[model samples]
Target: MRFSLIMVAGIALAACSPPVPDSGQGVGFGNYEEYQKQQRARDAQLAGSALPPATAVSQETLAADGTVVASNDGSDLAAETQAALGQGQSGSGAATAAGGTGPQPEAVYSSGISQENNFDAVGAQRSIESDAAKIAQNRAQYKVIEAEALPARPGGDGPNIVDYALATTHPMGTQVYRRIGVNLDGKAARNCAKYASPDQAQSAFLSKGGPQRDRMGLDPDGDGYACGWDPGPFRKAVGG
Candidate 1:
């Protein structure tokens, strides 16, 4: 009976305790030094098995004379290019005979100006005597236009504002004429709105008893000008 009770107590204690985890089966809690040694061995093996060195490539280029040459030297390439240009310029006739239809050297470098119409070319071709003759011919064709008085303002009853502007020497806001009425400025503002521009307002004012009289009230300040119109520009035009 005592032996059986001891055996039963040992079995119960084993069952109550957690089971021990296998290091190889789950997350390894094994030798870190061993793992490092394995890694170092793998790196060394990879280093020893590196790929072979690449072979040097020899590049060949075609020369201008239709021959394949090794382009190892830069000087050789530049010499070949210069030789090609010289051959093209010197042997253009030979190339044309061999079925080449490219533009001639002259056409390629031409300034696009025809020799006949170019001023420098024409000047080179002309003699001093010829130039003097041409100048005389041109002068003979030219005519001197006599300055005539601008034909008296084509007879119109309505006063020409151009004439009025030229006639008036007074500067703006000089009050050349007399103005008397209630709210003359307000009347002018309202009346000026009816015209498109100050010039139009002045023209209309002149036609309907303006300058001397303020029938339309466009010239509120009695300056002979209407709707803030200035005669200075017109006066200046004639050098008045």
Candidate 2:
């Protein structure tokens, strides 16, 4: 009975011994696999939540020789874009054609001047004719008034004194003379008119009295006056 108890105790101790190293390695591998699976799931979730990748071309991309390549479905998108672009270009072209293209040069035009001159020769001629007419009229009027003459006076040249006296005294008239009939030793004194009327001559002679009687040697013919004026020639010429 003691021996049987010892064997049972040995068997129990053997069963309680630590596992092998390979067995521990197997357990670690299982834990590592489980951790990798969890990491994969987390990665997938993050990827889904993040923003999408960039598609446009930037300057950096161009420098790197990375051109933008449209997707296979981008052909249809390109066609639509091309149609819109064509429409815009057509509209712009129409507006430009109507508005005229490029900077318009400044407008230039030729300038010309015209001159005209006119003179009224007829008016000048009329003025000259009027002046001639006035001059002729004035000459005619003066000739009519200056036609008469006068008797000569003493102590000056012939007729000139008479003309001057006529022009100054009577202007336009006749002359006559009368004798005083005064007696002298050798000659007789005669009285004559210096004016137009015979009565005027007689009055002048008598008013001064007899010529030699009043003042001797004053009258050459012993007349009352030194000079005698006669109007016979003037009257005969004028026929009045």
Candidate 3:
């Protein structure tokens, strides 16, 4: 009974002593909260040191053969799809008629790019077809409604298709022969419509063709006026 009492008293004394620190910081284990904190820190450090296997962003992105598909951003989707299809054919024991080990690659098709950049947006195809179908009908109606009424037909197959080279009149109702490109390097080399007197211009115009002559591009607006030169004096003298 005395030995049992001594053993109990020794156990109590041991329990009362301060706990030793693991890191040898000379700091004894304090309260339960401090002990818990130290244990958590040690556990976290161990967890951080022993590295874990890297996990992929998505396992579905990998092909069945363990080759990583370069289709994370769908950049290689078409190629990957073609490869998968070929693999599928080979795996199915599909052989060529010549008894080849695997099926030969004939043509790999991808519906993704079948549009070929000519994608038909919603209603676009229907609109185009409708326009095409009604084009001839619309043209016929237009021709019937706007038929030209002429007193005499010109020397041509049709008025709409005039042979300008053979015809004399211009589209502007002026005589075609009057249209001439002039290169004036002398006599009136002025930049604009500068004239000493309108009489001189008027005389030159009448003799050669007044409105028909624009030697220096002076008549830019084609109002028979050149380089800011007024035709008032010329018009007045000629009663034009």
TM-score of every prediction relative to native = 0.49, 0.16, 0.16
lDDT of 1 by residue, 1-240 (tens): 999999999999999999897665435737766788898999999999996568754456776698988876567767877988999899987777788686656645666789988889888989789989999999999999997777765666666778888876778888878888999989889999998898888888888888799899998888788999877888887778
lDDT of 3 by residue, 14-48 (tens): 99999876664335654667788899999999988
How would you order the candidates by lDDT, starting with the best? 1, 3, 2
Best candidate, TM-score: 1
Show the colliding residue pairs in model 2.
Answer: 210-224, 211-223, 211-224
Q: Candidate 1 vs candidate 2: which has greater lDDT?
A: 1
Compute the lDDT of residue 98 as modeled in candidate 1.
Answer: 85
- TM-score: model 1 vs. ground truth: 0.49
Clashes of each: 0, 3, 2
**lDDT (tens digit, per residue) of candidate 2 on 151-240:** 545763322322323333222222222334445322313322235654344334444553224332223343233344343455455454
Q: In angstroms, how far off is 17's CA in candidate 3? A: 99
lDDT for each candidate structure: 0.83, 0.50, 0.52
Inter-residue clash pairs, candidate 3? 192-227, 193-227
Ranking by TM-score: 1, 3, 2
Worst 10 residues of 3 by lDDT: 160-169
